[model samples]
Target chain A: MTSSTPASAWSRDDTGITVTVSGAWITSRLDQVGWPKAERSDIAGQVVVVDFQKIETLDSNGALVLHRWIEQLRKSAATVELRHPPAFYERITDAYAQSRTGATSPPTGRWGDSLAEIGHRAIDLAKATLHLLSFQGQIAVKLAQTLVRPRQLRAKSVVHHMQAAGVSALPIVGLLSFLLGVVTAYQGADQLARFGAQIFTVNVVGIGVLREMGALITAIVVAGRSASAFAAQIGTMKINEEIDAMRVIGLDPITVLVIPRVLALCLMFPFMVIFADALGILGGAIMATLALDISFGQFLRQFQTGVPILHFWVGLSKAPLFAMAIAAIGCQQGLMVGQDAASVGIRTTAAVVQAIFFVIVIDAGMSIFVSILGV
Target chain B: MPFIEQNFAEPKPEMMPAVRVRGLRTQFGAQVIHDNLDLTINRGEVFGLVGGSGTGKSVLVRTIIGLLRPAAGQIEVFGQNTQANSAAAQALRRQWGIMFQDGALFSSLTVSENIDVPLKEHTRLRAADRRAIIALKLQLAGLDPSAGAKYPAELSGGMRKRAGLARALALDPKIVFLDEPTAGLDPIGAAHFDQLVLDLQAALGLTVVMITHDLDSLYTACNRIGVILKKQLIAGTIAEISARPDPWINDYFNGPRGRAAAFAGAA
Candidate 1:
């Protein structure tokens, strides 16, 4: 077998210009060479022939490139023609050309059709936004009522949800935070050593983990794990008509399903933040002692002095808000699920994406507010 | 014209059954769905498989199509064992098509693209020829040409089913398996579908195995009925099977719904 890169050579004479393409004219060798550029003076109003008989192999991509070159030549009034192209290449190029032309020439009256479609989508988005706001208001009112009548709260269900979302999620959150802390400490040690301030690596790891990394990492992890789960579970129940069944029996699905999950997340987020914070600090301390020749006791001492108590409080304070956003987005998407198996999958994915996006936006807002307040 | 020879007929090679199953056993965990079941479906006929819910009617069809493995059984389709997964079995698969319940159309592709998938895989036809075939298939399946551009999610229940049927018939298979073809259609729509199936069967000489609980479909479309009861198949012409003394069979064919369907079919 011959192993050679694809190349094209062109020669011009009184009759015409002939371009011969050879070697593997396929996508894998697309980077090797391109078609040779012909001088306009040599081929002006002259017959041009592209010979593909010497080509070893050609695929769709190569055919498309060649087809475009031929089109360019014809557009320039060069009277171009292809010579001895393989049957498969001819078929593919012809098929692609037909589809391209067919797609480009839109049928009449399609403009009106597209305008109506855009109008429909705009209305749908507006309706969804309004519905989500109204749902949030309804949840606030329900929570207020529960606060007034304390006995209306489902305590057992709340506890169960807390265990599932918090206790069950502890291992993953701890492991991720520890890894984050170790990475930060190692990177900080290397950069600080270059500046002749290696001891200050402890402060970098300490303040960063406490003020931002710990809370952000835990929130993102919980959003991915628990938010999708909540959506899938409720969406499945909606599909089974269990939510409708509850409504028929005079029970509010929001009160029975959404409230417990939201309340549990709100109550558990602070505890998860504290656990994540401890693990993150411990990981930083271990990395510092092993690689930077700093003792564990010295690392802890620097952490205590360099990182203020307010930094820990600020990070902890973001947790409940992040948790509330994640829970609300998840349960709302689930409740809005349509009556099909496919909708469950769609809603679950939407829940995770929306939860993480909202968490990041909320964290940004909090950072700006705290900086303005100088806390 | 040949009465004596017809009475003592000899079986011809071309008249062999399309599908033959013997001693089929299907189970999930400790729950046995079918035990020692046997069935035969002849060529060039519409065979209706009827059973109550949870009776493994869908499982049996899936098993025969090699989607589910049987605990113990011999299932032969087009004279090749479907369980072997050999080249012959793979080739045999191209001879038949299965339309799942709920259409099961690819959610991403447009209707025309979905119908072209099998053609692209199995044939070397030109692009223009494939497009013409797609248009012809849409017309044959009773869909408008405009419907070819719509996604499966954008289609209504009836249109999705028609698009599914178009895809199933893309390869011009000799046999087609339909699961609950008329389950969610309106009466008029279902009747139109039945008539379409009948016309296509006669025109193309297709063998069909359909799972349906709709008694009207049984009376109007099926030439023979196979009832699943007590983990076994009792198959015959409708009249022959209805004459059996089984209590479930009696209730099924003689019940109010069944009788109304039978009367309506007669009318």
Candidate 2:
């Protein structure tokens, strides 16, 4: 690769043309540096000299160049002589000579170095992983320092994340949770109709949406929204060295950066869950009122009596825990970023994956604990 | 008591040598950066440690500030062993500040917010007081008042360095660690940085441990010079080292670039 480039890059004085491989249409070497056609032409009227010396390597280009010149020279009744060629080039000519006599030799340049390129890439990735670890330490120190010393909150940033995690999320969470409630109510109304127990549909839909599905749906929505938000935000900061700067100034990025976002999510998630639950329950009530022919007052009364406060608080408690898990995973992944753009991508992937994994595992455990303890 | 009597009889402890690093050694895997390095920087002195890339000059300064842990050796800051995780070691470090090669200013934070960070974290100053302090420090560092609202990315390279300097001296730190403070600057910018360092040192009464390869920086600012080579710090006064024939020093100072810097300074 190295040698072949310089060969074609320079021009011979007599021939005044660059040499590159063409005939073989593969990795073929040039055998020798024949005198540039002029010297030989001067020596013998029919003599032609082609400089294979500059043709260290050739593809179709060298072959075409040779073919064109040789064809022209042959028409002129000139004989071509080869000069000093590399050993590899001699092997090529010898094989061509043998092949002309029906001799056997394998071909060159059939996807060569593909496996080597793959291996080289794998080794680079592994080395990069090790290099990334040092950067993690630098980031961790920055986090620690930022923590030891607290700084003013970025009102703009906090508001931005707040709007994304809470304000913007309202429609989606509202749509899904509310629709789930309506479906619950519709199904309940259908079941109760057989026994003339249609009014009980209000209690069923209300309790179900508010207690279990409301919180569950809210959490799932947040796992996708806020968790990923944390990952992208922290990851961007990591790539840009904002986290490191935070440390130099003795500000704990985690306590300052992560804590605020986590805290915001913690406070907002449960409220969002409640808000989503209210919307969902209202949706269920609407479905019930329409299907069961139950009035709003009747539906409200049934719902208030059926679902206990314990159910409400149980789901709300998990919001902060989910917030903690998301923050920890996202910030940890961000701090793990290296000195390159790829590290941010890798860490962001890790953040989302880890956040979702922990949220599920912890949520399941919490649900069980709450149920077992009769909360 | 008279001012002279008070100054002489009970000299400030900073003047008694603020940062003393002795027999410092650190390594990353098989590569030993600093070994058996000893350095003592007096208060109000701009001590320059110069060496080529990978010569451990930066490593030595980082080791002093407790950024990179030393594999072997003792670092005493304000007469306390800084390597230990004791309260005293941490307190000693609080008296020092560092400016990294790239300025290392918080891109997300505005200039005033960046400078106000140290005060907000360490002291119990009111927000107004902190703002006042930040403004004063910014003024002292030769940065404009309006720059406080600008982020690191928004500022010029020279402005970034100045803002970083303001952050470093925000708490009136006695010892300032500078790692390639003037690196990546144009000639005029670099000269301006060197003069700013001199002005800062004089105004703040700071002891600076600067890791730099800029020959002009060494001449303009440093009181004592040190070279980190072959995993050891060779320290001497500027004149003392000029008289010596150390290969690294010869190559650095007597080399073409070094001689050119000297000639420029002379002119």
Highest-scoring model, lDDT: 1
Quote each prediction's TM-score.
0.72, 0.45
lDDT of 1 by residue, A248-338 (tens): 9998888889989999999999889888888888888899999889998888788778778999999998998899889988899999887
CAPRI quality of model 1 = incorrect
> Best candidate, TM-score-wise?
1
Model 1 error, position A37 (Å): 35
Candidate 2 regions exceeding 4 Å error are A1-375, B1-15
| Span of ten consecutive residues with least summed lDDT in model 1 chain B | B5-14
Question: Which docking category, incorrect, acceptable, medium or high, applies to candidate 2?
Answer: incorrect
lDDT of 2 by residue, B1-267 (tens): 766765446444434576777777788999877778777777677888877787877667777788889988887777767788887776666578888777788766788888878777776545644655565666666677777777776888878888888898776676888888888889888888888888767644578888887888888778888877677767777668766777877787888988888787677
Local accuracy of candidate 1 as per-residue lDDT tens digits, B119-194? 7887655575566557656766778777889888789888888899889877667789999988899999999888
Model 2: how far residue B267 lies from native, Å: 3.3
